[model samples]
Target: MATPTIKALSAVIFALSSNAMATELRIDNVKLYQPAEQMFSAPTSIYIEHGNIVKLLPSTHKQKVADHVIDAKGQFAVAGLMDLHVHLGSSGSNYTNFQYLPVEAHFNANLYLGVTDIVDLFSFDNVLTEAKQLQQTQTSPNLFYAGTLFTNPGGHGTQFGGKAYVINQDSDIEALWQQHLATNPHVTKAVIESFGGMGNTLTDTQLAELGKRSKAANLPYFVHVSTLADGKRAIKAGASALAHGINGEDIDAEFIELMLSHNVTYIPTLAVYHNHASESEHQQISHQTELLPVLHKKLQGCLFDKVPEPNVWFKTMWQKRAHAYQNIVKLHKAGVTIATGSDAGNPYTLHGIGLHNEIDALAMAGLANGEIINAATINGATTLAVDDKQGQLAQGYKANFILLNENPLQNINALHHINAVYKEGVKINREQLAERNQIIQPVGQECNANITSQTAQAVIDNFNDKNQWLTVSDSAMGGGSATELVLKDKVLTVKTSLGKPTHFGAWAGTEIRFKQPNDASNFDGVALTYKGSKAPFTLSIYHSEVQDWDHFSKMLPASEDWTTVKVPFSEFKQFGFGNKVQWSAKSITGLNFVWRSMPGTPPPVPNNEFHLKSIGYF
Candidate 1:
C-alpha cells in the first residue's frame, strides 16, 4: 500500500502552537478518505496553506486561529474528482458558440459537481490556449488538453472543424511531429474510426510512427477507437491508451491480456450510450435546474431535450451497450485499470453532473464503491499522466477537494450530494461563481445589425458566361486540391485533381454566389445539368441562418454520362456545416459542387472529375 507523502511537517507545529499564518485555511471535524488504507479516518482537522495540504490533526485538537475556516461538521471529505475524458468544446453544435462560451459557466459547472480537474481530449488551439490561462485563477478546475487531433483526411475529427492535423502519407509524419512539439500538448490524439473503410484509418506504420514520436517527446499517445478491430489495431500500433471502450463485441481473454500487457487504461464512457439507449434515463439524471443561475442557457436547453428521438441506430446501440457493459466488467475483474469518463458534451452528457451518471453506470457494471471512487480520483489522474500532482488527498497534494453531505463509501451516488468544493485551499461560492457569468453592455453603441455583405439571389448561368462561375477547394485550409472552370468550344468544364493531401480531404469545386440572400420558401428545390464519370460528388446548398457551416449535402447518383438531377429541398438534411437551428425555407445562401471524402465514404484519394452546365431552382 502506498502512503501519503508528508509535505510540510513544520506547518503542524505552527498549527498546534496557535501561530498559524494569516494565509492558512483550515477544515475541522471532517472524516477524510485515506487512500492507502482504502477507508475513512475518524474526524480530523486539516490545515492548508499556499494551496497545499499542510497538516492533519485529531478531532479533539483545538481549532487554531486561521484566516479562514470551514466546519465540515463530520461530513465526508475526499480528494477532488477528476474527469478523465471531457471536451469543454466538443464535436457538436455546442461548439458553434464555443468561442462565446462564458468561461465562468464552464468552470462553475465542474466545480459545482465536485470535478476539480478535467482532461480535455480535444479542443481548438485557441480555446486550449485560453483555457491554460484561465485555470490559474484558483476558481476553475485544472485543465489538460491534447490541443489538436491528427486524423486521416476526412476522418471523424475533420467533420467538427476543430484544429485537425491531417496525415495523408507516411511522409507527413515529420511535419506532424514538429507540429505536436510546437504545441506541447499534454497528450497526442489520433483517430481510428470504425464506421468508415480502411482508407479512413491510419496505416500501422503511421500509428507506430506517431507512437515513436510521442515517446521521444515524452508525451502520451491516446487513440480513439470505435470497434474491436480498431482497438486492436491501435494497440498493435503502440497506443498508450484507449480513449473509448469498444462497442458491439464481447471482450475476449486474448484482448484483455493485450490491454493488460500494454498497461493501457480504458475510459469507458458508458453514459454516451445511455443517452442513446434510454431517454427516460437521461431525464432522470439531467438535474440541471439544481445548478441554478449559473447554468448556461445552452446546457439548460440540453437538460430539457437530452437526446434525439430514438432511431434504429439508437435501438442497435442499446443492444450493443449491454455487450459493452459486460466487457467492462470482465476487464475490471481481470485487474485492468478502468476509469470513469462520461464523454460529456457529446449530446446528453452534461459537464460536471453527467460524470455522476458515469459512476452509477460503472457501479451497475460491478465496480465496488471504493473502486468507483478510485477510478474517478486516482485512476483518472493516472490515465492523464498527472497522478503525481493531483488526484489524491495527501501532504504535497494540491488542496483541491470536496466535502460531501453523505458518505460515498456507503453509496457511490453520495458523490452527487456535494456540500462544498475547495480549490487551492479556498472555498468557492456556487452562487457568486454563477453570477460572474452574467454579461453587461458592450463598449460600442447599438446599430451593429446594419452591416451586410454582398449577399443576394444568384442568376443561373448555362456555361455561356465565364464570370458566373468561381472555383473553391480545400486548399484554403491546408487541404490539397484544385478545381478550375475552363470554357472551350462553348462548353464549361470543371477540371479537378487531388493536389497534395488534406487534413480534411482533397477536392476542388465551384459555387454560384447568390446576388442576394434568397428565400428558399419561394422555390421547391434545385435542378442542375451535370455530367461526370460514374464516381460520386457532393452537391450542397447553403443558407445563412446556420451557426456554423449551414448546408445540406447529397451524393450525386452514380453516372458516366450527362444526367439531369433534380433534388427537392425536403430531401436535403441540414448539417452543422452551414446553419444551426433556423432551418426553415426562410433564408438560403448559395450552392456548392464538390467531389470529396465525406464521413462514411472511402478515404479521399488522388483522382476524381466532374462537369456542369446549368443550375436553377423551380
Candidate 2:
C-alpha cells in the first residue's frame, strides 16, 4: 500500500485524540455486500485497523477484542458510492449567482450523501490543487481529477471561461501533452463533440494523437462523445471510457460490439439529460439533502418556470434525452460496463444528490437494482483505475462504506436511507455537516429589494458589500495572461499581466457574480469610477438570456487618472457566435472588467493596474 500523506496521518491523530475514531475498530452483525456474489453475505463482522479493512468474518466467528465495537444490528453495509463524472468548482447551476459555492461545501455534500469518491472530469487548476491539498486533513470525499480538458478552439469544452487546452493542426502536441502531464492528472479527457455542427470539434488525427500520449503515460483516456460515429471513433482511438452517452443516434449492434471489444466503460450521465427534459421544478432527493437555503431557492427558481422559447442548445439537449436513455438500456443489455455519473455541475444537477438521481435514472432505463449498485461502485472504480483499493467492502480494501437502514439489494431507494457513512474507518458526523450547510450560503448579495423598482438604480457591486469576486485569465486556455484582484478600504484593485497572445489572444481581469438576476433594465447603462493605466479596458455584461461566453461587451477608453466611465447598454456588442439581439438588462447575472491583447499585437509591459471605487447601473 502507498504511504499516507502527512495530512492523512494528522487526520488520524486528530480523530484518535478527539475520540472520534478508535485505533482498531470492529463493526459487528452487519449484512455486508459481497461484490463477487452480487448479494449480501450472511451476518458478518468487519475488522478495520489503520484505516484499512483487516478482516471480514462470519458474525458467529470467535469474538475478537478491539478498541471499539459497533453493534450494527443487521444493517446493510455496502461500498461507499462513487461519482465518475463531476466538476468540483461549479455549484451545479448555470446561473452565475448559484455557481460560486465553496469547493469544501461540494466535498462535504458528497460525503453527506454517502459518496466517498468522485472523479472530476474537468476542473480549473487552482480548484484541483486546493481539493487535493484539502483531502489530506479534511473529511472530504477522495478526489481524482483531470485538471484541464482537451479540445479544439471554440469547441464545446472551450465554453464557460475556456477551461481547456485548445489545439489545432499546427499546435505542438508534445508540448501541450507535457504541460497537461505536469499537473499529475490521474486521467486524461478530450472532447469530440460538435453540437450538430454548431461548434468546432477535434479532428480524428488529433484524437488519435491524444490517445497515443495518454497510453504512453499509462493514463486512462476518456472522451466526451455525442453521436454514434463519435463514440465508435473514440473507442477505436484507444478510449478507456465514454464520458457521456451517445445522444445523436440509437445504439446499434456494431457500436455495442466495438465497446465490448475495446472494454470502454460507458458513463451516460443520464441525470443531466433527464433534468433538462423534465418540466419538474426540483428533485425530491435534493430537498431532503442538506443544501444552503439560497442555493435551494435558486435551483428551484431556475427550473420552476420553463421558458416559452428555449435556446437552440437547450432544445437540443432536451430532445436528446430519450435517445440517451434508450442507448443506456441497450448498452447495458449488451453487457457493456455502465458507470454512474451525474454531470452534477450542470444546470439542474446538485452535487451530492446528483448521483442518487443518476441511479434513479438508470432504474428508469430498466436496470435492476443490483446492476445499478455495481455501476455506482466497482464499475466506477474500474473506470478510474482504482479498483484494487476502492469500490468494494472486501478485506484489504480501504474501509470506505455506507451503512444503511435497509437492504439496498431489495430496494434501490434503500441506498438513500443511510444510517452512517465511513471513510477510512472513521465515521462521518452527518449532523455537523447539516449545521455547516445551514450557515454556508452562496457568497453574494441578491438585489431582491430593488428587483422590481423601475426607478431604482441597481448597485451591481460596491466592493464594500458581502459579495465574492473572482480573478480570471486566459492561462486556463493555455495563454500566459495572469490577473489578481484585491479589495481594501472599500476600493477594488485589479492587477493584470497580458502575456504573449495565443491564437485566441490574451485577457485578464476580475468579475463579480450575483446570487440572483439584477433587474438593471430600469437603468440606461453601467457606470464605474476607476483610475490607472491608459491601456484600453472592456466592460462585459452577462445575462440569463445569453448562455455562452460571448457576453455583450463595450470598450472603455483609457483613463490615466481617476475618472468615471459610463457605457450605454446600446453600446455593448456580442463578442462571439451568439445571436445578435437587443440588449435586455432585465436579468443581468454578472459583469467583468477586462484588459485584452488581440492576436499579433506586440506583447505589452507585464505591469498593468486599475482601481474601482464603485460600479452600478446608472
Candidate 3:
C-alpha cells in the first residue's frame, strides 16, 4: 500500500480532535442558578453532551461516567449573560484609540466578560452577516441582528450611515416590507422619537403597518422611545418591546397599565445614560487585560482626569440618568418584564463590560441581586424569543454558563469574579481569544515610511497621486449618500449623490489621511484649487486632539469656475460638540473637502460633481 499522505494524516487528526470535543463533559460539585426559579440549587453534577445539558445529577450520585470531568469545588454556575442592545461594528466609544479595531475584537471582549450572546439592534447588513458567519469558525457570542432600522426620512436612525429604510407619506409600505424581509432580520426595529427636535419620526399609521408586517412574519417588533408618550404610542401601535428606558418623563400608572395590556417588554439600557453621567465604573475597569492596549491607554488617560465644568450637554445627560433610574424602579415594581440592554458602542459604554455596569446600575435602581441576574439572562433571552433553548442552567438547554468564584444571588458584583466561562459545553480559551483580537492598525499607516519632512510650502497633494485619496459618504454613518473619486490628467474628480439628509444633513466628500502625524505649525493655512457644484462645500481639518465628528472646519465658496481659495488657520472653528481648544496644528492627521446640506435644504438631486487640481499649505 502507498504511504499515507500528509493531507490525509491532517484530516485524521482533525477528525479525532472533533470527536474528542464532542464527547460528554461532566462538571461536578457546582451550585447552579435556576433562572426560572430565581434561586440557586444544591451542589450538582451537570452532564453535558453534544453542546447541550443532558442531565443534572446529585453530587453524591454513584454513577459518574463521562469522557471528561471537572471538579468545580462548589463554585457557582449560572447561565452566561446576554446583552440585547449592541453595535458590534463600533468599539463602544469613538473617542478611544481602539475605535478602529475590527468587529472580532468586540466579540472576543464579550466572550471574555462571559456574555454568551448579543443582539445588535441596528447595523449595516454586511456587518451583521459577517459577524454571523464568524460564529461558525470562532468562539464567539451568539449574535442576533435587526438588519435595518425602519424610520422616517431624516429620522434618528438615519443619522448613522448605513442604509436605514426611510418611510415617507408616499412610500409603498408593502414594497418596503418585502425589501426589509429580504434582509432576513431576526427582529424588526423602528424609531419613534422626535429626538428633542433633532429629526422627524415615523407616524403611528406607518408604525402599525410595519408592526403588522413583522407579526405576519413571526418577528418581534421593538421600538426606540425615550418619552412616556412615545412608549404609549408604540404599544398602541403593536410594539412587542420598548427598546429603551423612558427618560423624557417619569412613567406613570397609566403607561404601566397600557404596557401590561399590550404585553410589551421593556429593555432599559440604563448603563448608557449612567455612563454619560459618571465615568467611575469605566475608570475602575480601564486597566483590564481584556481591553486592547490602545483603548486601555486612552481610557486610563481620560477616565481619571479631574472632572470638567458641566456643560449643557453634561447637565442634560445627568438629568436623563436620574430619570432612567427612577423609571426602571417604577416599572419593575409594576411587574413589567425588564430586560438588560447596555446600549454598548455609545460614547462610554464598553461592550462586554457594559453589561456588568448595567447590572450594577440595576442594583442601584433598587432591583434585588436575583432580579438583576434574571433581567440579564432570561429576560434578555425572552426578548430575543430564544428562552426555550438559552438563558437557563437546566437540562435540555444549551450548556452555556459562567462558573463564578462566588454566588451572585447573594452579591451581584460576584458575577465579576469569573473563575471560568463555558459556551456550548466547551471552556473558552480566553488568552487565545485576546490574541486573535489584536487591534487593527489605522488606515494609511503602511505609507508612513514614504512620508517626507514638511515645511511651510510643502505640498500635501497635487491630484496626481490617486492612491492618497479616499472617497467618503454619509453611508459611513448610516446616511443614504454615495461618493466616487476618479483621478485623470493630474486632476481629481469627485462624483457624489448627497442622498437623503438626516438631522445632521447629508455629506459626501474626499479625504487624504496622513500616514504619520504632520506638524504644520510653520504654515499659515491651506490653499486648494477647486471647482464644484453650486452647493456649499467645507474644508475640515483633523488632528490628534479631536476624536469625535466635530472637527474644525472652514466654509469654502461654491464656484462654477476653478478658483484658488486660501483659508487662514485662524478661520477654522469647531463644529458639533467637540471641546474648544487652542489651535496647535502640531499633530495634523488628515483633511476633508465635503458637500453638506443643512436640515431644511431641498432633497438632493443626483449626479453632482466636483474637481480638485491641487492642495497644499502656504
Work out the TM-score per prediction: 0.74, 0.71, 0.77
Q: Which stretches of candidate 3 lie over 4 Å from their true place?
A: 1-26, 57-69, 93-106, 138-140, 156-163, 169-171, 182-184, 273-282, 288-319, 345-350, 438-453, 458-501, 506-543, 553-571, 585-597, 601-618
Alpha-carbon RMSD to native, per candidate: 8.4, 11.0, 8.3
Worst 10 residues of 1 by lDDT: 440-449
Evaluated at residue 133, the lDDT of candidate 1 is 70
lDDT of 1 by residue, 1-618 (tens): 765446555666657666534538878899888765668889998888899987888878776666778778999888898887777764212322232343445677788778888777877776776676776654688876787887877566765645687788999989877887787778888888745343457778998899888878777788988788888888887788788887678877778888899888888888777763444444555443454454544444443443334444446677677788898888988988888777776755667766777887888777888888888888877877777867787777888888987888888778877778888787878667656644411122221123243422333566665556688887665555677778765457777776644344456787876666666576678888777744677788776554345467777775677788888878877653322454555566677887776433453545665667677775
Clash pairs detected, candidate 3 = 160-477, 160-478, 161-477, 161-478, 161-479, 162-478
lDDT scores of the candidates, listed in order: 0.71, 0.79, 0.78
Angstrom error at residue 554, model 1:
8.5
Preferred candidate (lDDT higher): 1 or 3 = 3
- Tens digits of per-residue lDDT for model 2, 1-618: 999999999998976676654438999999988776889989998999998998888999986667899999999998999998998878765453343677777888788888999989898888887897778778989887888998886566665674578787736677788889999988999998766644457888889999998999989998998788889999998899999888657888899999999899999887877664443434344444433322345344444434223334555666666777788888888889999989888766778878888988888788888899999999989888889988999888999999987888889888877889999999999878766765676654441224542333566667786537798888776567888888898888889998766556788988877766777777899988988865878889987667557789988877777898888888899975554456788877789888887666765556689888888888
Q: Model 1 residue 342 lDDT?
A: 76
Which tens-of-lDDT digit does each residue in 1-618 have in candidate 3?
899999999999988887665438888999999876788889899999989999998898874567888999999998989998898766664343333446777788788878999988988877887797878788889887888888887677766656878887736677778888888888899998676666678888999988888899988899999888888889998999898878656788899998878888888887787664565434434444334332333343433343223334644666667677788888888888888888888756777888887888898888888889989898888877898899888889999999988778888889876778899999998766655544433222121123443433468888665458898877765577888988899988888888766667788888888866788988888898988766677889987566556788998777889999888888999875755656777778899988877665754555578888888887
Put the candidates in lDDT order, highest first.
2, 3, 1
